[model samples]
Target: MSLTKEQTQHLYHKLLDMKKELSGEKKETESMTEEVGELSNGVDNHMADHGTLVTDRMTDQTVREIDRELLEEVNHALQKMKDGTYGVCEKTGQDIPYERLKAVPYARMTVEAQADMEDELETDAPSFEREFHEQVKDLSNKETVDQKSSQTYEILDREQDSK
Candidate 1:
């Protein structure tokens, strides 16, 4: 079933509120240089300190990008509302449940369709489990070699002591 007028209005307000909040947050975001102040210009700082600064800048950039993406999603949802397509799954052309809409006012697809899409993406992605197992196997082999080297060193020390 389609959403009632009152329900749509309620969701519209929710989306507007979310958009306002995200917009305000985006505006408040500061550049890493501004946030770090003169500390970034200090030549007396250690290499680790410089590395941390770089990492912090990268993290900040990532967060800003994520916020930008979410703001775009919120804008898209607002546009969909105007287009009279809100609360309908974009993928299946079916009515999205009101409860789901209430929980995630910006959702574009039904839960099932979203899950199916995620599964499809996962199928296309590389196997994380396989990569992890290979890393573990390599570490185990390195450990064994280190242990053997340590034993040989001990044996040589013992022979030197006897001499």
Candidate 2:
């Protein structure tokens, strides 16, 4: 299925927007890395008190992961633009809806194909009970920490009263 000139232009514009967004994200990641480097050498008392090293490292990792995904999508869209298949679905020979392509220029599957793939993934994954139990276990650990902190605070208050 071939797109009209207008449709092609629309998809091209969408791809351009995605490229711009990814570039901005890449810059943000670079800035974050620089900040992390600066913090590593700093002796500021606030930095020591906040203990944000772990949080910064995790944030940098998350940003890098997102940047990688965005770069992949940008590359895929550029490839499709080169091949004149920008709006066509990889799974079906049909032309993907313009709205969908506008929303996700790198999408390889039509809506129906995407839905089918999601359904297949859902069936292949472990049962909800297993996932629920894992979540419950995580929440229980957090609750335990909260309880411990509260008890410690109560004991400290009682000691202050006695003093």
Candidate 3:
């Protein structure tokens, strides 16, 4: 289901507000990063100072990346609103509640759908240890099957020879 005109307008305002806020945040992040710029003064700065600078730079980088991604989501949500697809769960094609939309104007999926997507994402990455163990177990099982087949064949040959 689609949103009512009033709901659409409300969400549109909410999204625009979010866009403005995110833009400001992105600008702030940019300034923070510019101030924390390169590690070129390695020789002049004390080791602890340099370490602190590097740590701050790393933290700012992560923040910048997160803000950038959020900006993209906000932009996408705005576009969806323009395209008349807002307030509908992207995964289920059902209307999202006004409360939910108010809480997260950029939400593309319903809570249940989002949870399911997260579950799928979490399960997609197999742990290296488990994968390695499974591969080793499979190889050993194949070898065991092959050895049993050979032993069975040898027993059959001995019976034929006795006959």
Top model number, TM-score: 1
lDDT of 3 by residue, 111-162 (tens): 9998898677557756665444443334334364445354434555787999
* CA deviation > 4 Å runs, candidate 3: 25-46, 126-163
Error of 2 at 105 (Å): 1.7
The order of the candidates by TM-score, greatest first, is 1, 3, 2
TM-score of each: 0.68, 0.59, 0.63
Cα lDDT over the full model 2: 0.68
State in Å the error of residue 11, model 2.
1.7
Q: Tens digits of per-residue lDDT for model 2 on 76-121?
A: 8788889877777777778888778777778887899988976776
Candidate no. 1 TM-score: 0.68
Give the clashing pairs for model 3.
none
Best by lDDT: 1
Error of 2 at 151 (Å): 30
Mark the regions of model 2 whose C-alpha exceeds 4 Å error after superposition: 24-51, 126-163
Model 2 poorest 10 in a row by lDDT? 133-142
Q: Could you arrange the candidates by lDDT from highest to lowest?
A: 1, 3, 2
